[model samples]
Target: MTPPAPNIDPLTTPLERERVLAAYQRACAALEAAQQPNGAWAGEVVWNPMLICQYVICSHIVGREIPEPRKQRIRLSLELQRKRDGGWGMHPDVPPAPGDHDHHPNHDRDPAGLAGAHDSWMFHTVLGYVALRLLGADPNEPLLQDVRAWIHAHGGPYGVPTWGRAWLALLGLYPWSELQPLLPELWLLGDDSPMHPRRLYCHMRLIYLGLSYLYGARTQADASPLVEAIRGELYPEGWDVSRFRATRDQIASTDLYEPIGQSLEWLFAGARALSRAIPAVVRRRALARAWEHIEFEFASTNWVCLSPVNGMLFCLAMWSRDRRDPRLAQALQGLEYWMWEDDSEGLRICGARSDIWDTSFALQALCEGPQIDEAARAVDRASAWLPRAQLRADILGGREHYRESARGGWGFANEHHPWPVSDCTAEALEALLHAEHRGWDHAAARLDLSDKLAAVEFVLLRQNDDGGFGSYEPRRGSMLLARFNPAEMYGNCMLEYSYTECTASCVRGLAVALEALGANMPSELRARVQAGVDAGVQFLLGSQASNGAWPGFWGVNYTYGTFFSVAGLLAAGLDGEHVAVRRAVRHLISAQRDDGGWGERYEGVLESRERPLDADQPSRIVQTAWALLTLQQAAPERGREAIERGLRFLLDQQQPDGTWPHDAAVGVFFNTAVLDYRLYKLVFPTWALSRWLSR
Candidate 1:
């Protein structure tokens, strides 16, 4: 007879078990209460102040004055985000000190001169300064003076990045000719062409669509006294159009994340030459083509377009073509969907919404714990809502528009946000499967056999030739496209490449669906699901770093990636003793803190694949939960002590309201900006503790 397996559930003491049970109950109550009446859970996605700045700039250019009350709130937001040195950084990591602008080391000197001085990138600083002025802050005020000094020290607005240049140019503060050409004719390229815009990543292409349209139309605001005054303030030395033209390619060291390569420069020069050579009629036709694509996207996404970045650009493009167009007003109104307001933080435009992502994770967390009656009712509602959220039909002319099949997939934000992502669909499917496993007959009825089959088909279609999955679409362009990436503040953004997080999510979802569907699954669909899982597993196994971590594309560093990787492997029938699983568990155990939790700095996303350990950072509640979940799934026996201690850390940190502290940035985008998803604090911790109780 085989030896009996050791007891993996490590809750030995009655006191410890009692504490965990009580914590679970409180957490369940808190999460259930936080759910929306529509049965979805969405938290504010806090990003940098650049979004607010863009809102201000867009309103000013479009000739719509922000209401006085709204401007006061926007002013408060700017003041709260200001650094001690009177500059704004990408995120609010460094607290501002009162009246300490002069003493801050980077106040007088060029902030770029100091190592790790990312607290004030020129991109945010210039935009923040201008946004404050637009909101009626006095230019001669002491705080504004300090901001001006900082800007002058950083080589003035001339050194800001391409996106900054575009915004300034729209307001007539910068010359359009000086900016790099975003040729609308690129839309005319055939789908077979490697350089086609369709070959670019979804977000990149959409943003470029709006940008090129505006650039083609030469959309600029009519000059006013405010524009002239702001221009003088921006260039204290003097405002010379020729001198500004010379600094077209210049970027401040503080704002440079991915330096513009020689290849990209050549591409820009060629684009300028093409712009000059193209026949007037052909150029007109290309602009028309671009507008058609833009209008399609605007309608498909329920007028929200993709994100605030493109949404504003699309509005400007529409306004430039026909100011009285009804669609323009609707587009502007739709933008309010991305706005988050608070009496304290004022109004902020988030990068994107997270309703589907948050709801899927929250449902999974609820399913892992003991089923209280209230929790069960919440699960039923969420499960019902999720199936309804799935896209039931592909968009018309999806192939013509360079879109993948979204028929059975879920998007990151909601059903109205119709850009389906691989991981979002997978996580949503897994959440429904978990509900089905819990014997929720109502959920099963809502998500019938055909619906599940369509979802599996959607996931199966997202797998790349390399066996991994990209976010929105399959990899469409070469990795060499990185050499031509024009976005100065981001990296690896040119094409949709495969990511570990997306692959792992697909694998786990397919495997769980396969097991749950049992013999009810059709033979053909079952084989395709198995093939996708096997391919996805191979991709995961080969992608592990030498240090046993996987790099995350959408979240912070190794901790987030490793959790999904380990969980996916286990769901695919890999045992804890497998070399890959064992190495991953060892890595997590080694990285645990003295406080018995885990923390990963956002900078790890910028480091080499073998991210160095940052031992000095304080443990974060969300990352700690990720490590605990990974260990529980992959190494219960080996990670028992670490799990218990981590549990204690979480329990001690829980507030009287039953939620964990959201003190650190958890989500990341483009490997440069960090995001604070407020709901992450509730979902991941609740899941970890509940998993422990069930075991």
Candidate 2:
């Protein structure tokens, strides 16, 4: 017989009850100490190895020596992340523990099978090999040989995705013909055209604008011996430049997350053929237009360029244009903003800063606790930072870069990141409102009523016709646009689509805004807000799965989506007795573990299902907290037992310093890649425990 399961219930005898209170106090103190003087709670944005590799490549392009310490750190990061066969996983270390591999179709027991199960891609492997080589690892190093063998087994250099092919060409390791045509002329299309860059997601459009310039000019770095060495090692059978033209559309199965459709291929083929006949004057004008847009993006975002993917591509475009421009120096300097260094992993690039995102959640968590007054100092400090983080009207208006107005919204990271996201804006508004209602006395520099209304207006502008919200803009195009997705490293990244998470956040935030506005809100504005809330609720209700769960696009699986769904509806004035709320509560109850917590695997989100859990894959503190929060909002009376169990789980997991260890990734993008936002564990769990105790 198996040994009895571990007890997860809180040790709540009269003698042990004090420990919970002490733990809560410790957590509050830790957050207070961690707050930045600027009122932000910026945390590490842990991502894959590509950003580090991009950094090394950027340093090489700019002819700057990476500091000895940074170089060593890069080497160590690659060393720690490299799999047994010398390739890196898509995200880091994604295999299940021994005996925990479940019945997924992708499960494999061999080492290579384990790597594939974790979703290793040739796109990432090429970058890893390039990074190692740039860091001065010998070509004949055993690790390099192993990496080469893996690449060869997968399909060699030609099998790389579009981005990889472009990077290789930039390094002078591959020919330009290896990449499909990225037409800068597409910029000439009218705004009304469905193919306009404005309609694409911010990341896709930004990267495309810059990459098209590089491809159009056929820009490449000066050939060096190292480049020759890369070319030799990548193609052991000896490569011919002529071979690339024939295999432009060829991508390896390992690298292809979403294959370009034959129709898209035909369209691209036609564009390439038409480009040959275009007059030189038209080509020159198109390149100029592309350059102008690229420069505008840099100026707007302070050279950060949205994310590292586009940031580095913009840098490459600048380098290709005028290597000696003073602006290049500033762009290089700004790259440090995304660099994260730790004792174990050295340095890697974060997907984004996500300061506002983490801080908003942390504030909500603090306010939910019974002892708001006890945590007053921490609350005040963080609250003071929120109003300052909102975007001003002076930023880019929609007409110029095909951007939506950012006047009153908030972004994921800091003010320097110009794009305002729907969920982030909603969360920020909610946090600010919470601070005000709780009487945190934010009189020093709080946003006035006008500013608050402007934020509400921003949210209103982003609501889709269907009542949901997209990340950056309202849905300008259809999900079918993904059929032309060129980036095989990710999926569903081609267009902006509404998310259940963003929709929920917006509805809840508007409710708070309306409450704060009260009679002061204009009659028309209030009517608009009420309509949006109703439509949004309907969207959430309609989108709920047959299993009573909502799927999260930005976080792991149903847990993330359901939490926002239940809480948002309740915030919009739906009661616990509502059918949608009742079903959601049941789903949470069923998902609760024997240990009284909740755990969700990243694979579950990738596949949009409840993935089988590995025996060793224990419940996560973050998911447990989310479930607790959801239940409290949806049905407090019925969820009391589960909430207590979740609170106990948090108490048990709290570190001595009042932090939670970085568990598995809680953030996702493109429904495939798992990313870590370090503050999720600390902020969400602490928030849940505080609320549970207060209730």
Candidate 3:
């Protein structure tokens, strides 16, 4: 039977709520300044609370201490996030929206509106409390008491999620056996074997690598006297190591969003039973093979490792491997990449980095910005350097990455990290298109980036039987790996799910790229684009639910998906009377709030065969921009007012410096819950104003 979750205390002193609000506001202002031309901040650029935290962290990084007003704002934000029990959520805009599918009863909505209800997730719990703690609440406060109690009840040190366990293992807090095997051994499987971790999504593979190494060595952390004491406090009963690993099937109900199927569960049971009998000689051979892949991962990422979960584990693994290992030492250099500081709280780890990813769009958004000359020198620098970032060759043992064809391109930062993300490339291209059209003084001289569009040629080759594209590359793996998904901090983030925004980005980018190539796009490539556009249009049309929204895979939620997807479809010619366009426009219109803007919950990004979680903010700057863009695409008939209202919302939210207050996350794609998108406010709003006042 599942255990009861920690009950977030319902009672709150009004004074406490006000304190949180002050911190939250201060954080928002600091993050607003971090935008690099485009909308993204720096790392894990996602929607909702991720964005909220960016503002908070940025506030602390710049402010001597969080200003009093800012601390109060942040504190209030956290206080309201307190559910009936002691746990916290990723966002305040989540939770309790009945009509919103994100809050649907059937799905594992946090009724409180959190996704990782996944109580097994120590990362969120630790970080969630850390956020509140930073906001000035006492760590020993009752709210944290419930959280600490919850973590302990779940198995405390032993009971954390695999990802969280990996982190604790890094700190030498938990032994690896309490975890299942993620050894490099899986990488030895036949190419066709779907079970291989190497074949898993990049984010998952990186995270698993860290888990595998630490688990392989059976490392255990040294417990402090307080930790030993708290262990008793967390679990009423003493910790039993053997019993913890035996409950492999044990999962919190909230975390069972995707339960392991009987087929896999039975298969795993059989594998475990067989491993016991494997000859020591054979086991030695397996370990050797596993080490080869481990070395490869280390080499590929320059030891920065993949994402944070894996990065953290890799940090521990390297440290254990050797105290002074260069890679391990370097790996620790970017710890701040994931950690955010706020006045209310000092610092906490964040999900991932946004360095190159955000800049790709930021550059483009700057291209589309009203003050195109604001960053003219920076634009020239970016334009000249962009062509240099393209992928002209494959990486070491590259194809095993299942990279498929290496066409089109990605601009999440530039070509060095080019993994061929469809939307990142498409969005980058659109931004470039904007710049090219703007005819900057150097536009003609620097027009050479045009030839680099050959990457789009690669994208045309990866289109699916359905005519849509997946992020990073073609969708080649199965959903079966989702069951092995070890990240309790997020669900199904280990594999590619069909994304409307990603597909749309590819569509629009391809169209723009083809136009730029002029006659260079061969008949074969043009035919592919034609097929992609036609199929994409149908898929999008078919995708519009009765409620009229398309959920996003890479960003905040539905409003995001609807805008990017509809923009792609209409741009590809499905506008005017197209039934799909009309329905989508109808949905956006229906959602338009009295404020003359639209808002959605980040929860809308989730798709439960059971239900969905909606992002719960009204009139977000990003959503409003997306809605305005869609209206222009599908309903120019609505005139400028539709666009006008959205622009006004963006303008209204804009700080005196011309940046908008972040209201939601503006990123989404294959993996990683996001943060950053500092430029979403600037770029999208700028685009909206330009479009509304079109010549």
Candidate 4:
């Protein structure tokens, strides 16, 4: 039997029970309306990683790590998803769990077999197995058994995923000839053209850049004994070593996120046919360029690299290039950042760090009122993360390394990416400054920087002359370039766009930076402030939909955006009493279901699905936080009773653990999928409840 989920249904007071039921009904109705075929349960997720992302996040916050054992359990879950027939699917019901392994799957005679029973791709299966294997599961483990059996049950190693083969090539399980070569030799090709790997999505480019160099020379490890053993079991007829060349271009339906353009395909085919010879000097130069990029990513990111997957692969890539490399050594040593541990699972790597991103607002919300106890607790967390997350060493590699100056910036989770994400740095700095204001000592010792204001200065540089903010970096490319997005499953990754949440965070950071600088701020600082305020109002006003909603680019939906945007507007001197503001407030009120609480489906975040919204969908704690914050900002005198009722709903919902239960996802990206901002459950309530206490 499976372990039971924690008790999530909190009991409520009499009045609060009625309120909770009403809100539950409201949100449930909304979700029911938003359902897709089967149980895909997509409310806001766009890139299709919503549920998977959530499982990773919730496990981290609760267990405080992604333990290897937990990862193995995830593998079991994925295995259970496979049908007896031999295929994987998007949802639980899609490719019904395999009914019988003995059943011969005849493709033409069995339409039902093809209906849901077919090998989708080995990529997801490979990822699932890797996660399980990392937990110490051997080749014979039930989960691996199902995966390997399914691979052979479908055909053989030749039926495996292209991406899976590529990863395995690095592991020495497969030869490089099987991969559609992402040649770093292409770096020898000029940069101005669209062929450069740097032109890909930030996430994808981060992975492929390191991979090309590693794959170009066909780097492979001394295969794990377990891996070699599994090679025999993974393929029937004893695994053909050369069949990969013929099947290299095979496309499994599930693996096709976007089709390669005919032009790019022709170029690749043409390259394969060509001699593909480059001058020895050019090869040296290209390898040098690749090394520079690899080192830059390592230095800027403190050898943490972008994601754990890439971070691990890049570690191997660096080792392949130079066996005695110090950068490679640092990456290996620092691998613990991604390695999470728990009692159930000994050790499992995290998707990324949560403590930094989670702890920031945790500190600020705790500081809002005079809850000195909670404030001190949050202070301790921020105190521990701050000094450690700072970049004390100079960067080592990349084009930006040769740029004018180093911006002492921070990443989303620690100093892992050192990429100087403008808002992340601003938010980190603000959190640190708040910690200082709350009387916490800077726990990170010997942390001195000549670049004291480098991060804030970076923020200033990022601010447009008109005064708006964008995520990651400035808006450097065209939005029209989205048409060329090869990752069909994703949207809006080609360039940065100004977002209200980012703008609010940046604006608030500036206010704190001004305070930190004291009267030493240039006279121009005052001018900049006014310019920011003016530009911010215009951005906020223009962004508001005709229906009086501000579509959230990041969070679950409009309610999240409205709360932050309205708070920023009010902070910037916009009067809620104004007719437009009043109408927006009323729209928020009218949209609220009979339930005293508010709940917006993730679809509302991704697609701007405003209502006549749903009732009977239980109101989530995070949504309640957003609504309460909005109500507080709107300061709707007549609506105080309703707002107070919503407060009771939250108070009643708090668990003995001092946390609320996870609800439906509350974040969206690429405007199609939802992500769980699980931290929102804790931080938003802490901030909201603190506001109520102050009241």
Best by TM-score: 1
Ranking by lDDT: 1, 2, 4, 3
Q: Considering summed lDDT, which 10 consecutive residues are worst modelled in model 3?
A: 1-10
Off by over 4 Å in 2: 1-17, 95-119, 372-374, 396-398
- What RMSD, rounded to one decimal, does every model reach? 3.8, 5.6, 11.5, 10.6
lDDT of 3 by residue, 243-313 (tens): 66676555544333345567656765666666566576665566556555556655665654444455555
Would you estimate the TM-scores of all the predictions? 0.95, 0.93, 0.76, 0.72
lDDT of 4 by residue, 210-234 (tens): 6777766567655556556655665
* Superposition error at 652 for model 1 (Å): 1.3
lDDT by residue (630-686, candidate 2, tens digit) is 897677779777877877778888899988775577788897777777788788877
Cα error, candidate 3, residue 193 (Å): 2.0
Query: Best by lDDT, which number?
Result: 1
- Roughly what TM-score does model 4 have, to 2 decimal places? 0.72
Q: What is the C-alpha local distance difference test score of candidate 2?
A: 0.79
- Which 10-residue span in candidate 2 carries the lowest summed lDDT? 1-10
After TM-score superposition, the amount by which residue 61's alpha carbon in candidate 2 deviates from its true location, in angstroms, is 2.7
lDDT of each: 0.83, 0.79, 0.54, 0.56
Put down candidate 1 lDDT per residue, 492-521, tens digits, no spaces: 789888799999999999998898887988
